[model samples]
Target chain A: MSEPRFALGQRVRIAARDVAVHHRVPAYAQGHVGTVERICGLYGQPETYIHGDGQPFTRLYRISLAQTDLWPDYSGSSRDRLDIEIFEHWLEASS
Target chain B: MSDHHDHDHARTFQPDHTEPTSDAALLGLALRELLISDGHYTAQEELRMMDAMQKASPHNGALLAARAWTDPDFKHRLLNDGANAIKEMGFNLLPIEFTVHENTDSTHNVIVCTLCSCYPRGLLGMSPAWYKSKNYRARVVREPRTVLKEFGVQLGNDVEVRVHDSTAELRYMVLPQRPRGTEGWSAEQLAAVVTRDALIGTQRDLDINAVAD
Candidate 1:
């Protein structure tokens, strides 16, 4: 197993994906840019690829977001903010 | 304006919105009555829970908020370890027992469970109805900003949202930030500023003139 390749304050973008059941990643965030604020310890490997009690994937990074970036026509106070958690594979370093 | 008046007349003539025919209301009433008969709780306790749900005021929360506003050290303690810290301020979080987690800029926290309304009943009293509904459990984690926006919270793109998996023993209560413009205010006045919404993180801490509103 390899250590997750993300850290706090790093810039990243969400990758596009589809699944039938619930997922921690939101659909709207696909391809959107965000900054990692904190690293939430870890979880096992992505269950999608792993099976039979295999080593779990490491989950990390709590990301802060702006309201306007997530939704269009959002005119709320600029100081207002949101935070969310994401896994390692869901993100790729922004160029 | 005639259309408005005619619409109002028709609405006034129709049955009241308070009609008690809804199955949920009937079921809730039945549950209350059964619980009372079974000695699970007195009518007064049940009423207290109802009143808290309606007005959502826990006098103890107000007191703690007031103290925290004035005392930096106490506020730090509460932020670090909420349960025991609140006890030092003279409030108890053990009616049914719960865990309180503070959400911050680095980490956001929302509480929910798909199974049942397992909440921190100790501090906030009983959980609100929406907390248990499938709508909240399903959407909060996936679309936190949208859900919070519906609740009148508008977070910026820079903030993060973290949804917690609340189970039997562990639950959550949101401790909002202390507002500005409350300089030199007494604990009583500060308590007046802290509303029930602040406890659940639905509303931000009260501004100086917020009490008037």
Candidate 2:
């Protein structure tokens, strides 16, 4: 299997296609910065939003992000963080 | 567990609009009982919780307002772990540990459960009539921008819309960002900024001007 899309502390951006309907991924941090907190098990390939066509995919990642980086004026403590599940396809290495 | 039935109100979800139904009310009551007996909530707290549900707008806003005013740490935590972090204020999760996703310009978050009304009832008292609507569940993913506009939440040309399909394992809620202009306010004052509609991401938090009116 190809290496996971992101590693711990690696910056990433959510893919444009995964921004469509019927997904579990949240919208706020689509192109946001989050560190790889944990590696969830492989759940087969990316889901085919196209009905009836299941394509083979790679592993997914559970990322953790600080709230400050998410909201521009966030004044909370440093410990505040949000965790989300992103498929390999949804993320791309940040510049 | 086998067949979920509600005598008070019918558990119907209509996206466009809803006519209050006794079945849904009954189902709400039954669900409340389930939470109470399961030790998730107490009788007295349930009454307040139900009242908060009925008084939806301002009552729901209380949590967000509080976060905006004093607990900067909490505001961040809530944005991070939407449901769990709210408990610090004594508001229990309606039942299950629901998923809460914050929506911002870079990204927009919308929620739907294709099969049924699987919401984070713990954080948000009861699913609103529109949330249960098939229109919302079916259309949000297909055409997010238009749907959000209908709800009065217009997205910027630069922002991307992300639809979330809620499931049995995970429920969804939204923590909107704090509005500016309320300087040096107490937590109580800040809590007032958050309305029930805001938590669901249907509306943004009320600003100082909106609060004045």
Candidate 3:
């Protein structure tokens, strides 16, 4: 297992690149910024697993985003949040 | 802007979306046949597994939640190490990581799989059809409050709603706060009000006095 590059409570942005194959990153979360809510342990990347690749564990982080930040027209209260699991490789440090 | 006649005509020719074939069912059948033929597993073993899964329902989760609600020490252990805590209750969740999110007066927790429908099947049985729908998968992360409202869970402005997307290895189940007016109820009686939807965080306001049939 590789050491996680990002720490809990660190701000990170999801990579905006498009992948043609199997991937776990949701299209809605792409290019969005969130704080690492938890270190959800290391696991084999699903993108590689679908291609028959062996276990190449990577840190999975539960990133938390305010609902209003994700959607411009969000109708809920600003206190609402959405947590998405993102692999370490797909996250970039946010400025 | 749309005419009533046009809407009625469109509804007449609507496709039978409910009758769509399940590719997962077909694939499961094929895999089971192959595995049995190859002697990897026998039909009898598969039947036993199916029976076990059938017996696994929301009641199991309700029992656990009822225990947590009555016993503070058990609740602490359940929140700390869910997998081990469930094991103590005779459930063997070996490989799957189980996590319990407690709902309080100020905060509410809901579980969803934005990537795919990953759920705590060992405790709550199979995921509901709505949980796997594309609209839910896409909208819940973006508009959880709206989706939850459709399921009759309306939170106050002061309450924070947190949606947990189970996109990876962890499976989550919400431990809803015990409803009022049920102070002297036993664990079994309390479990009656712990509906499957409540365990999933969609229905929080449970009527504790109603008896299960």
TM-score of candidate 3 chain A against the true chain A: 0.92
Ranking by TM-score: 3, 2, 1
Task: Mark the regions of model 2 whose C-alpha exceeds 4 Å error after superposition.
Answer: A1-95, B1-61, B205-207
lDDT of 1 by residue, B1-213 (tens): 123224222222223445547899768656755666678877566556556555534555667767876887987776655667877865555432234445566544555654456655555556678877889876664566677778777777666555554422334566556667777878888877776655665554355676753
lDDT score of residue B15 within candidate 3: 30
Provide the lDDT at B123 for model 2. Answer: 48
In order, what DockQ does each candidate have?
0.06, 0.06, 0.67
Candidate 3 matches the true fold with a TM-score of 0.86
Off by over 4 Å in 3: B1-28
What is the C-alpha RMSD, rounded to one decimal, of candidate 1?
12.0
By TM-score, who's the top model here? 3
Model 2 residue B64 lDDT score: 56
Chain B TM-score, candidates in order: 0.64, 0.64, 0.84
